[model samples]
Target: MSSRPRRPAASSSGVHLLSSTRVITALVSAAQLGEDDLVIDFGAGPGTITAPLARTGSRVLAVERDARFVADLRRRFDDRPRVRVVHDDLRTVRLPRRAFAVVASIPFAVTTPLLRRLLTPGASGFSRAELVVEWGLAKRLTAARPRDLESAWWSCRFVLTVRRRVPAECFTPAPRVDAAHLAVRRRSEVDRRTSSILWAVLSAAYARPSAPARVSLQGVAPRRITHRLLGGLPAAEVPAAVWLALAQTLAADRNVIPPRGMP
Candidate 1:
């Protein structure tokens, strides 16, 4: 069996400084964090956002991989009961089993995979996430509600919103591009196997809107994939919901899946 991932050495490019007091205040207010909340500050660098988060009366776990930042965080929150320093790579740490919120000015490099860990089907105890990420990525994610070809398959599992745009100047290092506050709220649960099939089918279909929607299921009779299951709609016109419903219906019977062709 494969062991869990190990903590990684901190990357220089991954470290951008988010130390503006004004921005921090605005983010904390927007998140509505309080004493009752448990928040994970992923990529917590030098205790910038983490310090303010700790002040919000919320229980804060600051995850940092750099030894320098981890040492600083430990010293900064040494006497505080509610603030804990996790000197490990955020990607390697599994979120606590108890329900928690995420408020992080995350490293730009790890945004996608970290989101997968938080938003994938069947994950538990995830209440919400307020993230500061690249503007382009956030725009793509929220371009269409749960329908954008890339995010659509996972969209039903969470309510993701791009709240506002943040300027590059907000960070000390000043990233070449702008960033945004992306909020994600967990919604109702769907069957894990069904969710997997949905992505699998879409993964195969990665079809251009103009192309015919093709789903190649091996061994299963083509007759089983009738117009009814396909929503009687052309491939390009099919909504994410339709794809999900179709995959769910198909997944209930067997281990059938898409042929795996998407990039």
Candidate 2:
């Protein structure tokens, strides 16, 4: 029998190569890929996850910043026409104009920035993503009430959840903390107008995150509606759904113009 190909050593760039084929397979399977889908493997370290993603017959864009791994990934997937290897920084890479899904075990560092590229409101054609991220970060992202403004904004347009926890030993040169499988899927029901309105509301509320919702949202909505929706909760503790409802209420009313200058 042929021995499994050896994986390269971990790099200073925070690439922790998943050591177990079983774990890699499980991550890919959760993506539910097929021939018609387009998928991206961010930080495609030595093509471990890329290989299985290709097997699903989905068009795979294996993006890696490291030159050595880019070369190795090219050579490994050369025979697979469906796999396209792109050497670029994940943070700055241009996302697909067409609909796409992401299935990746990203580097531990730069997790937040990378996700911002994919999940930020108005990001083009991002349908779903299954990411392996730091456990603490995952918990914060999937919390009942988003602690930060960005997480709250992201939750408005996508559903963020922790699918499962992955042990540290699953990777080479194990990380200090365990990781979690984070699932993100865009909210199909949220239209462009709703997203824009939510961004406005969330930005205003989070501007004074510690303040009571009524105070933060003062001029943005009617006192009766704001009080009815938010009650006594602090702006930071207000759920994304409530934010969305507030935006929708504002959108329905012709008199209330949504706050301008969305970032």
Candidate 3:
């Protein structure tokens, strides 16, 4: 008879395993997944979130970077065909080509990069996500006005909101601070063209974030139009909605051309 593989040592990769079943259930339930949905559980350490996610009847991609957890995950879900244990870095894992939802308690260390991959403009087939991220990051993402260009750009394409707080005690090796349930959904109303335009305009405006919106947006639209749309507000103070309006207006103008290299 063949012997089973020995369990590997604990990871030092900044992953805190989810120890609270109630928290796990709540997080998975919030995803509202069905069999039709395809979900990716980033940082699926020991199948904590992955198990409940599978119970939802959705196809689950349990992505883990550590070899130990990967082995454990594969063994735990071997009987469950719907759960595919992927032993790969979440940072580089291939996202689904079809529309998909994400229900995972991702690692705090790679929160920004993971979000960038999923929420960046033109990321194909990404439908929506409910992620467990650092509390500070959650607040920044859902802020009334994004603090930086990247955050603003993401806001132009998606609606980011905080669902609830996940206390630190919920994890086995509790983190220093609490986590938050950050919900991300694409802006169905905004089309590809509008998103492209927002990217161009916002990129220009944020280049000189302290400048008056009219001056910052002069390259994209006529000064008169920018002045009308933005008034005297600084580029930093301009919200995503106003930026969208500007992009939409620019998109409607036949005379105006998008900046070279714009998608």
What's each prediction's clash count?
0, 0, 0
**Candidate 2 clashing pairs?**
none
**Model 2 lDDT tens row, 130-246:** 989999999989887888888888888889889889899988879899999899888887776667778877777888888897888787678899999999898888988888788
lDDT digits (tens) for residues 204-241 of candidate 1: 55444445454333233244573566533444456656
Error of 2 at 121 (Å): 3.7
User: What is the Cα-based lDDT of residue 62 in candidate 3?
Assistant: 92
Off by over 4 Å in 3: 1-12, 254-263
lDDT of 1 at 117: 76
Give the winner by TM-score: 1 or 3: 3
For the record, the alpha-carbon RMSD of candidate 2 to the native fold, in angstroms, is 2.3
Per-model TM values vs. the true structure: 0.73, 0.93, 0.91
Which 10 residues in a row give candidate 3 its minimum summed lDDT? 1-10
Model 3 error, position 27 (Å): 1.9
lDDT of 3 by residue, 1-263 (tens): 11122222345876676677776777788788999999999988877788778878899999988898888788788888899999898889888889988888888888888888888746578888888889998998887677778888888788888988989987767889999988888988777666777788888888888888788777577888888889988877888788877888877876766554443
- Cand. 2 Cα-lDDT: 0.84
Task: Evaluate model 1: give its lDDT.
Answer: 0.71
Name the TM-score of candidate 2. 0.93
